[model samples]
Target: MITRTQLVGAWSLESYTETDVQSGEVSYPMGRHPEGLILYTFDGYMSAQLGSGRRDRFKGQDPYGASSEEYTAAGRSYIAYSGPFYFDESNGRLEHEMFVSFFPNWQGQRQVRIAAIDDDRLHLGPDRPMPFNGRLKTASLIWKRALPNS
Candidate 1:
């Protein structure tokens, strides 16, 4: 059985794909090689960030100077949130409490994910359907353990 201690570390995104519940179509919102990192701290805090394969730079390399269009483009390709998190050993699930988020709606929300680790990879499941380009889809996120710099 996996314990809370096993989850305390940095995990690198391996893949993120959304599958339609009805039609069974899979979509990669962040391309095949998107970048993301999820971290868990012993102090009971957690944070996650997932970015599209590549992002465009803001005008003059200054975000404050960017126009609304630039901001919209940037925001569309990123997913970020952070807060205290807890693990339920009996159920092997994680309750991710979002104190803040790039998507305003997630703030103050507690999201549950079925968690598993197989062959050194962490799989978060119970992929619930959500809006995806006008259709409902479930996201499947796969993560690998982050290794220290060699």
Candidate 2:
């Protein structure tokens, strides 16, 4: 059974890949050189940071034509959310019920994440298909457990 203790500490994003359902093309979100860090603590605190990238877009901009300004703004933005997390070992899933989110728009939303854990690596993605704009899509995020002192 997956326990909270097992998920304590920090994790670094290893890769982020997604497929555009409409275009039938695969995209490496953080690109071949993705940068991000996600830290999850047993005490129900979580923080995430994503770096600047060509694919990063603003709220109303076309994701396909995301500009450097948007990317820069997103890179500098620090997102922090605190909530309780539950793990369902039988189904290999993790759910986070957010009480407060740095992105005010996400406050009070419950985000469910399906995960696959192997050794020191954790792979996470949306529990269900995400509707991007108006199309269904999926995102694959890979994370590596950070050493205690690192």
Candidate 3:
């Protein structure tokens, strides 16, 4: 079983894959090469920020003052959430009780993912397929422990 202490740290996104349940097709939601960070605090707080490998830059220099088109593109290429996390060793599950999320619908939702911890690598995915676009898809996210400097 993976202990909570072992999970406290920053993890870099290695890969994010989405599989179509019916057709068994695999796709990368964040492009072929994505970049992100998932951070777990000692106090049980956690946050995740994921982005597409390539994204269009905002026309304006100030990020906070971006134009509508810039904001639209940025929002569509990024994903982020933050909240408290809990581990159920007995069930081998990890629940991210989201306090805030890019999708407002998930703000008070608990995202429960199957936990698979292997040394410095952690693989998390949903037990069943969830609705995505117009089909049912399952996601598996691989993460590696971040170095101290990261």
Clashes of each: 0, 0, 0
- Alpha carbon lDDT of residue 75, candidate 2? 42
lDDT of each: 0.88, 0.69, 0.88
Question: Candidate 1 or 3, higher lDDT?
Answer: 3
| lDDT by residue (tens digit), candidate 3, 1-150 | 888888889999999999999999999889888999999998989999998999999877897999888898888888899999988777667899889999788899888888778989988887778987689999999999999993
- Flag regions of model 1 displaced more than 4 Å: none
TM-score to native of every candidate shown:
0.93, 0.69, 0.92
Candidate 2: 10-residue stretch with minimal lDDT: 48-57
Model 2 regions lying over 4 Å from their true place: 53-82
lDDT of 2: 0.69
Q: For this target, which candidate reaches the highest lDDT against the unseen true structure?
A: 3
Best by TM-score: 1
**What stretches of model 3 exceed 4 Å from their correct place?**
none
Model 2 clashing residue pairs (backbone): none
- Any residue pairs clashing in model 1, and if so which? none
Model 1 lDDT tens row, 26-141: 88898899899999999999999998989888877776888999999999899999999989788777889999999999999998887888867888754377787789888889
